[model samples]
Target: MSVEAELIAPAELGTSVVSDKGESIAPQAKEAASGLLDQGDAMTSLAQQAPSVVERMQDFLLVGGPVVWILLGFSIIALSIVLVKLWQFALLRPESNRDVTQALALWRAGEHGQATVVLKRNRPVSELVYIAMRGVLNVRQDMDLLKDELERVAALRLNQLRALLRPLEVIATLSPLLGLLGTVLGMITAFQRMEAAGNQVDPSVLSGGIWQALLTTAVGLAVAIPVVVIHSWLERKVERVAAVMSDSVTQVFTGQQISVVAEPELEELKRAA
Candidate 1:
């Protein structure tokens, strides 16, 4: 009976240990399953909401009527112009100045050939500097004629940079007015509806109409603000480029004048020696 009791005690102890481990693992398993279920439910909810969000946007646009559509078109056109101007700036690098500085230094030091080579870069300022240096060294044209020619070239370059900027300005200027027009029209429509409804007019209807009328103004401002900022920034960039070109060309001519004045003095000193 004692041997049977000892054997039974060990078997019971082992069964209790297994039960304890199972109890601990069961809650952990349930927690992991609940976490996965929660994540799946969130993902499913987002998927269901996506189409509804799109529908709401479409309805909002439709409610704003033709003025909103016109603003939409303007926004697209503005975006396209901005992209084109950015690409043009990137390709031309109108802001590049280091090469122009180096070329001017070489020209001042009497290294005309090297200076011309230095100005060979694909930059607007470089092109202007190259033309000025070439005119002085090779053409030996009158300073007034050269200045006139440079002015023409500068005008052309500036015009290129200024391209499409007018359209952007127009868009920025017109957007708010168009939005105001839309709001006014919407307000007129809303009030007319209220007038038609007469004694049956509900406050909700008026409130809805007011908000919907205001929506055009909100969208117009949204479209105009960025466009105004972009236009100013782009205009400033062109101005900087123009300044650099003027400064560089002026330096080249100034250096040429100094050289011209010094050459006669050197010749006289040589004769005296």
Candidate 2:
């Protein structure tokens, strides 16, 4: 009778089984199903949160987008200037200092033709040497006149060098001022909102306004700092160019053994004649 009772209980359990395999569902399978349901709920919650994330991003852009654009414009201009200046300086570096020295020596030895040939043969440095040679040709024996002419040429070159750089300086000076303007505008907006909100001003609204105002200042500095650094570096380059000009002119003048001659004696001699 006990064996018969056990067999009946087994038959009842089999009848209760609803699994595809015709067996009771396993404990691990039940736990896995619960885990899947929890995962789905988490995904749904995350999906609900996505719109808030998008709103925050939109708000950030609405507040800071213009400042970012302005910074981008300035950066483009600055980078362009930097690249151009780098190219110009690289091209203008003295290619053959030794050739220039040899040319000076030849000119000092009274071999003016050979010196000119030396100047013509070399590249780039030749341009500088040629300028000095022209002054030598024009102000032949008058060192002061030659020096003055060489200085004039250098001044012209300097002007050319600084032509494009002026815009950079102007932009650098104006960027901060523009930032300040943006700050002021942002403040006005914030105050207007405060007035509109009246007694119900939210902290979030005020914080947003303040952040927007600060963006302009940050943008200004971002534009200004690099511009100043680039300007300073360019100014040094100009100074070095000036020094090179001076050195070249000096070499030519000294090589010719030329001195400024007083014209008073020549004028007296002409009068006597």
Index of the highest-TM-score prediction: 1
Which candidate should be chosen as best, given lDDT against the real structure? Answer: 1
The alpha-carbon root-mean-square deviation between model 1 and the true structure, to one decimal in Å, is: 3.3
**Residues 1-273 of candidate 1: C-alpha lDDT, one tens digit per residue:** 699999999999999999999999999999999999999999999999999999988998899999899999999999999999999999898997888888888888888899899775567788889888888886658878888999998999999999999999999999999999989998998899999999999998888889889989998998999999999999999999999989999999899888788999999999999
Q: Which stretches of candidate 1 lie over 4 Å from their true place?
A: 1-18, 139-145, 262-273
lDDT by residue for model 2 over 58-149, one digit each (tens)?
Answer: 67557765865676688789889889988877765633366777887887777887887876432344566776776567745585765676
Q: Using alpha carbons, what is the TM-score of model 1?
A: 0.87
Instruction: Report per-prediction Cα RMSD to one decimal.
Output: 3.3, 12.7
TM-score for each model:
0.87, 0.62
* Residue pair clashes in candidate 1: none
Worst 10 residues of 1 by lDDT: 118-127
Pairs clashing in candidate 2? none
